[model samples]
Target chain A: MKELLNLFLTFARIGALTFGGGYAMLPILQRELVDQRKWVTEEELMDYFAIGQTTPGVIAVNTATFIGQKRKGTLGGAIATLGVVFPSIVIISIVAMFINNFADSVILQNAFAGIRVSVYVLILNAVLKLWKSAIVDKIGIIIFIAIFSLSIFTNLSPILFIVGAGLAGFIAKRQQGVVS
Target chain B: MIYLRLFYEFLQTGLFAVGGGLATLPFLYDISDRTGWFSYGQLADMIAISESTPGAIGVNMATYSGNMVAGIPGGIIATLGLITPSIVIIVIVAHFLNKFKTNEGVQGVFYGLRPASTALIAAAGFSVVLIDLVDFDLFRQTGSFIQLMNWRALFLAIVLYILANHIRATKQLHPVIFIAFAALVGIIFNFGLN
Candidate 1:
C-alpha cells in the first residue's frame, strides 16, 4: 500500500509540475524516478522513454503505465495512469473554468511570451540530445540532415519522411552486416 | 459529419504520432489544411497554450482543437479517441511485457523506429521555428534573403543555447525556471500573447 501510494504521489508531482510536455518532462522524470527514488534504473527509464516515444498517446502517461506495471502490476498501471493524468484533468478543468480571466491578464500573457523562448531552447536541447543518441553513423548523419532539410523545405507529410528514414536506416544496417 | 471527421482525424494522429507530443504538429498542420476548421494562427495558439500548460502537448492541442470544433463534447471525444489506442496497447503489452522484452523482432522494430522518431521530432522543431521565428512571406516583400531574418528570435535562440550549456551552478535548475525567466523577458519586450 505504501509503495502504491508512493507511486501515485511521485507521478502526481511529475504530472502536476511538468510543463512544455513530455520531452521537456523527461530529464526531470529521470532525476526523480531513477536518480532519487531508485524506483527504476536509468537504462529502464531510457527504454521506457524510447517505447513511450513510439507508442500512442502522451509519453508521460505511457511511461507511467510502464513504470507502474513494472513496480506493482495491472493495478499499478491503472494507478499510475490515473496519477499521470490527474494533474492534467484537474489543471485543465480549472483553466477551463477560469480561462477567460487567465487569458485576459496582462502579466500572464507576458509570462507566456517569455516562456515561448525558453520552450524554444528546451526543444533545441532535446533535439541535440536525441540526435546524439539516434544518429549512430555517417549514413545516419546524412539521413538526419536530409530529413531535417526536407521537412523544413517541403510540404511533404512527416509520415513519408519517417518511413523513408526508417528504410534508409534498415538498408544501412543491412549493408554494415548488423541489424542495429 | 465534421464531428465524426474530427474524431477520426485525431484518432489517426494519435495512432501514428511517434516521438510524443511535438510529433503531432505536422498532422495538425495537415488537418488544418484539409478541414479548414482552424487556421495556422489558431494552431500556433494551440501550440503555445499546449506547451505552456500541464499534460502532453498533443493531448492539450487535441482538447483545444476539439473545443474549437464543437465545444466541451468535442473536447471529450477528441481526447478519448486519441487515448483509446494507447490504453489498449499498454494493457496488452503489460500482460506480456516481460516475455516481449527479449523478443528480437520487437527489438528490430524499435531499432527502426528510433530514426523515424528523430525525423518526426526534427520536422516538428523546424515547423515551429518557421512559424514562430522566420517570416518567409515578409522576405518575399523585401526581395532579399538577408532582409527576411527575424534577428531578435535568432539572437534569443543563441543566447538560450549558451545559457543552457553554461549555467553549471544551477545545473539543477528546473526547466520551468528558464521558462519563467523567458516569459518575463517576453513581457518586458512586449512580445504580446497574440
Candidate 2:
C-alpha cells in the first residue's frame, strides 16, 4: 500500500509539472524517478521512453504505466496512470466550463495569442533537443528527413510512416548481421 | 449512450495515435469531422488550452472533448477509455516481455522509432508556426508578404526563443513562467486585435 501510494504521488507530481507535452516531461521524470528516487537507471528510463513513443496512446501515460507495472504489478500500473492523467482531467474540465465565459474577451483572446506563440517556441526547443539525440547515424538522418518531408507535404497518416521505418530498420539490421 | 460513443471513439484514438500527444491531432480532426462533437475552431482552442496546461496534451484534449460532449462523467469515461489500452498493453509487456528490451527486433523497432518520433515532433512544431505565427490563408487572400505573418507573434516567439536559449536565469526558469509572461505581454499590447 505504501509503495502504491508513493508511485501515485510521484507520478501525480510528474503529471502536474509537465507542460507543453510528453517531451517536456522528460527532464522532470529524470529528476524525480532517476536522480531522486533511483527507481530506474537512466538506460531503463530511455528504454521506457522509446517504448512509450512506439506504443499507442499518450507517451506520458504509457511511460507511467510501464514504470508502475515494473514496480508493483497491474494495480500499480493503474494507480500511476490515474495519477498522471488526474491533473489533466481536473484542469481541462474547469477550463472547458469557463472557456466560453471568457472566449469573447479581447484581453483573453490576445493573451492566448501570446501564449500560443510561446507554446510554439517551446515545441521548437523540444524538437531541437530531440534532433540532437535521435539523429545519431546516416540512416537516422535519412529517416528524419524523409518523414519530415512526407509529414509536411502530404496528408499521410503517421502510422504508415512509423511502421515503414520500423520495418526498414529491422531489415537493415538483419542485413548487417548477415554480412558481418 | 453518448458516453459509450465517446469512450469507443477515444479508445480507437488511444490505440492508434502513436508517437505522442501531438500525434493524436489527426485522429481528433477525424473525430470532429465524423461526430460533429466539436467544431474545427473549438479544436484549435482545445489545442491551445491543452498545450498550455500541465499534463499530456493528449489527455487534456481527450478530457476537453469528452466534457464538451457529455459533461464531467463524459470526461472521465473518455479519459479512462483512452488510457485503458496503454495500461493493458504495458502490463502485458511487463509480464511477458521481461527480456524484450534487449531483444534485437525490439531494439530495431526503437532504432527506427526514435528518429520517426523526432520527425513527428518537428512536423508538429512547424504546423504550430503556421497556425500561430503565419496566416497562410490570409497570405493567399491578400497576396501581401507583411499581411501574411502575425508579426508581433513572430517577434515574440523569436525573443522567447533567444531568451530561453541564451539567458541563464530565463533558461533555468520553468516554462510556466514564460507562458505567464507571454500572456501578460499579449494583454498589454492587445495583440491579435487587428
Candidate 3:
C-alpha cells in the first residue's frame, strides 16, 4: 500500500511537470525514475519507450503503465497511470471551463517558448547518453543513421521507421552468424 | 449516453493512437467531423492549449474535449476511456514481457531497436530546436536566414546547454530548476513578443 502511494506520487510529479509530450518526459523520467529511484535501468526504460511507441494509447501513459506494473503488478500500473493523467484532467478542465483565451496569453506563450528551449536541451542530453548505451557496433550505427536521415528528411510516420528497424535488426543479426 | 459515447470514441483512440501524442491529431479531427462535439477551430485551440500546458498532449486533449461536451464528470470518463486500452493491453503485454525479453530473435530486434529509438529521439530533438529556435514563416518576409533565427532563444539555449553540461556544479542541478529559471527569464525578458 505504501509502495503504491509512492508510485502514484512519483508519476504525478512527472505528469504535472511535463510540458510538451512523451518526448519531453524522457529527461524527467531518466532523472527521477532511472537515476534517483533506480526502479528501472536505462536500458529497460528504453525498451519500454520502444514498446510504448509501437503500442496504442499515449506513449507516456503506456510507459507509466509498463513501469508501474513492473513495480507492483496490475494495481501499481493503474495507480501510476492515474497519477500521470490526473494532472491533465484537472488542469485542462480548469482551462476548458474557465479560461477562454488561455493559449492566446502572451505571458503563457513566452513562458512556453522558454520552456520549449529548455526541453530541447534536456532531450539533447538524453540522446547523448542514450548514444553511449544504444549504439555499440557498426550495425547500430547503420541503424541510427538510416532512421535519423529518414526522420529528418521525410514526413513519414515513426511507427513505420521503428518497425522497419526492428525487422532489419532481426534479419541482420541472424545473417551475421551469431545472436550475441 | 454522451458519456458512454465519449468513452467509446476515446477507447478507439486509445487503441489506435500509435507512436505518441501527436499521432492522435487525425482521429481528433475525425471526432470533430463526426460528432460535432467541438469545432475544427476549437480543436486547434485544444492543440494550442495542449502544447502550452502540462501533461501529455493526448491526455490534455481528451480532458478538454470531454469537459467541453459534458462537464467534469465527462472529462474524467473520457480520460479513463482513453487510457483504458493501454491499461488492459500493457498489462497483458507485461505478463509475457519476460518471454519476449529472453528470446534471441526478440533480442536481435531490440539490438536494432535500441539505436533506432536513439535516432528517433535525436531526430525529435533536432526538430524541436528547429521549430522553437527558428522561424521560417517570419523568414519569408525578411528574406534573410540569419534574421530568421530567434537569437535570444538560441542564446538562452546555449547558456542552458553550458550550464547543464559544461559546468560540473550546475550539471547536477535538477531539470525542474532549469525549467523554472527559463520561465522566469521568459516572463522577465518578454521573449518573442515581437
The candidate scoring highest on DockQ is: 2
- Deviating ranges (above 4 Å) for candidate 1: A1-14, A17-50, A53-56, A67-83, A96-113, A167-180, B1-3, B39-48, B142-147, B170-172
User: Residue-wise lDDT of candidate 1 within A65-161, one digit each (tens)?
Assistant: 8888889887787677667766665565455546545778887666665566666677677677777877676666777778777876787776677
* DockQ of all models, two decimals each: 0.42, 0.61, 0.46
Clashing pairs in 2: none
lDDT of each: 0.71, 0.83, 0.81
Which segments of model 2 are wrong by more than 4 Å? A1-14, A17-55, A70-72, B1-5, B16-48, B96-98, B140-142
If scored against the real structure, what TM-score would every candidate get?
A: 0.77, 0.83, 0.65
The runs of at least 3 residues in candidate 3 whose Cα sits more than 4 Å from the true structure, single-residue gaps closed, are A1-80, A95-101, A177-180, B1-85, B137-140
> Which has the greatest lDDT?
2
Clashing pairs in 3: none
Sort by TM-score, best first: what order?
A: 2, 1, 3
Model 2 lDDT tens row, A46-146: 98887787778899999999899889889999999999999999888888888867788888888887777777777788778778877789999999999
* Of candidates 2 and 1, the better by lDDT: 2
Question: Number of backbone collisions per candidate, in order?
Answer: 3, 0, 0
Ranking by DockQ: 2, 3, 1
Q: Residue A180 lDDT in model 2?
A: 95
State, as a TM-score between 0 and 1, how close model 3 is to the true structure: 0.65
